[model samples]
Target: MASKGKISIIGSGLIGRNWAMLFASVGYNISLFDIDESRIDDALVDIKQQLNSLESKNLLRGSLNAEQQFSLIDKCISMEECLRNSIYCQECVFEKLELKVQVFQQIDKYVDDKTVLASSTSCLLPSSFSANLNHKSQVIVAHPVNPAYYIPLVELVPAPWTDEKVVARTRELMTEIGQKSVTLKKEIEGFLVNRVQYSILNECYRLIAGDYVSVEDIDSVMCDGLGLRYAFMGPWETAHLNANGMKEYFEKYSKGIYDVSKTFGEIPKMEGATADHIANELTSRIPLEKLNERRKWREERLIAITQLKKTLDKH
Candidate 1:
């Protein structure tokens, strides 16, 4: 855990490129590594295109032009070249356990003693990949939400053997790159955010499957109701602010919430009629022929929302 300076990114995919943009935007020299040399070339192209997109939209940080930002990203052809003199490394490889294990083993072999080795794994835990490595204590999951170039919530998940010092340094480094991080005290399946997301998803599935709502209507409920409020306050904070305080809110709603929770049905298999409904509604809004255009629209909308959130927080 040297202070944030030179950083390395392994697996230059979507998340990897985002991590590189994040660090480089803050003036860190970055080494980006990937097995396919062409992927490095492609990532460099994609990142510049992405940075230019942000620049046009005034979403990127710093005053660097797209060319200057592109220059900060060095395509490291070898693992040795990638880790050389790097203070920290962020792994954004695929989510498979074996693939992660293999990558971590190689990374541990090349990493400096003080370098913090972090993963952008959404599912695999640190112990699942780094347990047997010599640099195990330095390894942890620093999972980022996609479009990390704009939306910057990094979930800091440390395994049982991951050192406290390493976690602190990781959190500090992420903050330096203008990323918000929440540290998990103990490892849990899907971590905090994904678990909460999955709970809502399960309920959405049940609602659609039980014929209580259409798939499109279910999504509209979130977009029109819960999601708008979530832009300002989290569920717990909303509960606290709704009444006098958290205690009073819980006292009044505990039984009701519990009863509703108990009455919730099991998750649907999502294979037959439910799947058809979802497909029909989703395709209506975003036809397969226009998927790429729709994806761009979604990303832009998220970026706009993120900008709005920043403006609101400033006041």
Candidate 2:
């Protein structure tokens, strides 16, 4: 018999499988549910292959071997069975507001008062799709970064009616599964990560639109410069450590920052010729046909960096 504290992951796509594997790594029974049986079957196969690959690379989480962790995941044929006695249900449906509404509504019908109903939405706010649910207090968004197997950051944003305990439990569970989780004080569209990400992207777009930089050079600025320091620390820490301290740092560069900030002006529209030029330049370096292959290559570097961080922290 499976544990009543099982984690139910709805949808067997990349996000869903990643969630299932993360929970299973720490001995949680994972019930994977999907509308398409064939997709579910494919997810299971992909998951096993991923686990084996992680094991060979000495990257598998927890004390358990790949087989032991893989054994903890089960494919569920029905939503009712999947939700039955589950302590948490993470909905990983396609990104559509209407689809999220339908999924949360149906899930609300089958969950207990204690079950945490969370969404894997990247952009939608909780109230947008879950306001009318019977278990509104239990609904929240636990958005994970893509390539979750390599990245550990997850943002937990709660609805206005969400119970405080729900936020606490979600954070605790994420921590237990080796993920770095942050909970928002309230819901916000796109949450925290994407907001900062877009701020950077907006600047990149402006640079390209004004012919100040090429697409490739902008990427190099991130990959070879900002990202190098950002891997281990954030902007705040970077500033604090760069000078004597925060106060001295501000005194020294505050005017320079203000002057540079003025030039940013308004965000670029990024339509028509600007968009076409950027797209063409990117496609030249990484053709659309080889996106998946590139993603794998990117994840491999991320994994190596993750390992390096772990080793450095021990000293």
Candidate 3:
């Protein structure tokens, strides 16, 4: 496919490689840059293999074929070259606050006013890193799920000083590339997804700690019970569909829900015997050696569900 414009992806790790492929599949020229030379080389190889695999399975995204998408990615030797003339750049570096600050400092120096400086951060607030940058107005957070190719939801967040136009442009770019994007009204720690995720984890931990449920049962509670309904609709929509509507549903279940929530009590520390027991159970089922295989298995299921949802929506 012909290029639309240039996008630079810093730190060519897993997230970076997925971002590169997603952008390239939609005809964007991608500069995949990493400070470590070998890492960049390895990313390129993995990206090629992934794209080719997707193509062979007829699951490749956008209008571009595997070879075309692979051709669009350029490995950069220097930050200067990667930042030059790019319309947007996503920093996919390590999640440490100090490391992000330093990387953004470097990116801020290189990028021009027109370029959008977005971070792929999961937990850190944008104000923490972009506050000291010269181009703070252009800085925003566009956090994607681990595998950007299948999981399309991206949380778009802007620092207080970030330009409104930058946020809009980031959303536009994400949509154009076929990713679902939502913008947070204001900044907060852990963003949207992680906050929801951690809430679930906390409860799960509490249950296990209290001896009310096993780790595997908690997993089944999600995968077999809640996960089935949540796959297509959110809790609110599911409530709407399950009952008459919001008002009637809330009237019927609010008291029961509130009562159950009150029973949750204090949060567990998630340490000591409970943590060790949970770890052992998980590791026994998914050993360290097969973790990667399990992760890949999970990603394949995500892709399948994504495809299923798309097909159903069309009908």
| lDDT, candidate 1, 102-171, per-residue tens | 9999998887778999999998877888889999989889999877776778999998988899999999
Give Cα-based local distance difference scores for all models.
0.87, 0.93, 0.92
Question: Which pairs of residues clash in candidate 1, taking residues 3 or more apart in a chain or in different chains?
Answer: 1-114
Which residue ranges in model 3 land beyond 4 Å of their true spot? none
RMSD of each: 2.2, 1.5, 1.3
Worst 10 residues of 2 by lDDT: 1-10
195 in model 2: Cα distance from truth in Å? Answer: 0.7
For model 2, residues 48-135, the per-residue Cα lDDT tens digits are 9999998998899987899988999999999999999999999999999999999888899899999999999999999999889889
Q: Model 2 off-target regions past 4 Å?
A: 1-4
Q: 126 in model 1: Cα distance from truth in Å?
A: 1.3
Question: 176, model 3: CA deviation in Å?
Answer: 1.3
